[model samples]
Target: MHVFYTPDLGDNEFYSLNEEESKHCAKVLRLSIGDKIQLIDGRGGFFEAEIISAGKRRVDLKILSRQLAYKKQYHFIHIGIAPTKNIDRLSWFLEKCTEIGIDEISTFICDRSERKILKEERLDKIITAAVKQSLKAYHPQLNNAVRYKDFIQQDFTKYNGNLFIAHCEQDSQKLFLGDLAQPNQSYLVLIGPEGDFSSEEITLAKSYGFKPITLGESRLRTETAGVAACFELNYINR
Candidate 1:
C-alpha cells in the first residue's frame, strides 16, 4: 500500500491529498476510485482509507480506520551538525538518518565551517520524502541554521539527558559515544565541519557542559560523522 503524508489529518471522515501527492497517486501510480491507500499524519497517526476520487490536482479518500503507531521506546535523538561543504552530502545524511530514525536535526555554523548558509526548505522536502519512503509515522524536526555560540547558549535547562560533542582533536580521555550514552535517555550530539572545530570552539563547548566524545578511531567527514552518531544512538537503544 502506498502511504501518503498528511500531517493535518484530523477527525474528518474524508481527507484530500496535496497536489504533489495527488499527482503521484493519480498519474504515476494510476490509482483509481475505491483503491485502498494508507495515510500518515506524521505524529503517530496511521489510517487506512479508500480513494473516493482520484484527480491530478486533488485526491479525496474516505478513511476506513485510524490507529496510532508504536512510539520510540528510547529517548529522542537530537543531532546538531555543521553544514557540509557540499550541500548534497548533508541532504544524503538527512535522508539516511530519517530512514533509520531521528527525532530532531539542528545545523550550526562553526568557526571552521565551510558552508554557513543552508537551504532549509529543500532539506525539509528531503526529510518528508524520506519519512514517506521509510513508512515512518512521525516526521523528524529540522531546525533552522544558527551560529555555534548562539546554539549552545540557548536554554537547555529542560533537557535532562546526555550532551556530547564529537571532535577530531586528540583527547586521551575521550570515550566512544556508544559507551557514554545510556539507553532510554535523551541525547544531543554535535558534529563539526570538514575542517573540524577550532580549539577555542571546542573549549567553549566543554565549558558549556558538552562532554567531548569520539565517533571512532578513523576520522570522518561532517555528514558521515553525523550519520555515524545517529546510527550509534539507534544501535544502542536496540
Candidate 2:
C-alpha cells in the first residue's frame, strides 16, 4: 500500500490531502476515487482511508480505520552530529537513520566544521519522505542547528539517558559504542565533523559527563559516523 504523510491528521472522519500530496496521489500516482491508501500523522497515528475525491490540487480521503503505533518503551535514541561539508551526505544519513530508527536529530557546528549552514526546510522534507517510505508512524524530531558549545550546555538531565561523544582522539578508557549502549534505555551520541572535534572541545564534552567513545578501528566520515552511532544504539536496544 502506498503511504502518504499528513502531520495534522486528527479525529476528523474526512481529511484533505495537501497540494503536494494531492499532486502525487492524483497525478503522479494516478490514484482515483475508491482507491485505498495509508496515511501517517507522524505522531504514531496510522489511518487506512479510501479516496473520495481525487482532485489534482485537493484530494479528499475518508478514514476507514485508525491505529496508533508506539515506540519501544524506555528506548529512545538521539544523535547529534556536525553537518558534513557535502549536504548530500547529511541527507543520506538522515534518510538511513530514519529508516532504521531514530527518535531525534541535532546538528551542531563545531570549530572544525566546514559547513556552517543547513537548508532546514529541505532537510525536513527529506525526513518526512523517509518516514513515509519506511512506513514509520512516528516522525523523528529535527532540531535547529546550533553551535557545539551552546548545544552541550542544554539540560541533559531531561533526557535521563546516557550521553556519549565519538571521537578519534586516543582515550585510554575509550569503549566501543555497541558495548557501551545499554538495552531499554535512552541514548544521546555525538559525532564530530570531517576534521573531527578539537582537543579542547572533546575535553569540554568530557567535563560535561559525555563519555568519550569509539565507533570502531576504522575512522568514518562525519555523516557515516552519525549513522554508525545511530545503528549501534538501535541495535543494542533491540
lDDT of 2 by residue, 145-224 (tens): 99999999888895564899999988997898787777888888999999999999999998898998998889898888
Candidate 1 achieves a global lDDT of 0.90
lDDT of 1 by residue, 1-238 (tens): 9989999998799899999999999999999998999998888887899999999999999999998864645578999999998999999999999999999999999998889898899999999999989988889999999999999987665457488999998887688999999888889999999999899989988888889999988989888999999999999998
Where in model 2 is the C-alpha error above 4 Å? 70-73
Provide the TM-score for each candidate, comma-separated.
Answer: 0.96, 0.97
As a TM-score, model 1 comes out at 0.96
Clashing pairs in 1: none
Where does candidate 1 have its weakest 10-residue lDDT segment? 67-76
Q: How many steric clashes between backbone atoms does each model show?
A: 0, 0
Native RMSD of candidate 2 (Å): 1.1
User: Model 2, residue 135: what's the lDDT?
Assistant: 88
Each candidate: RMSD: 1.2, 1.1
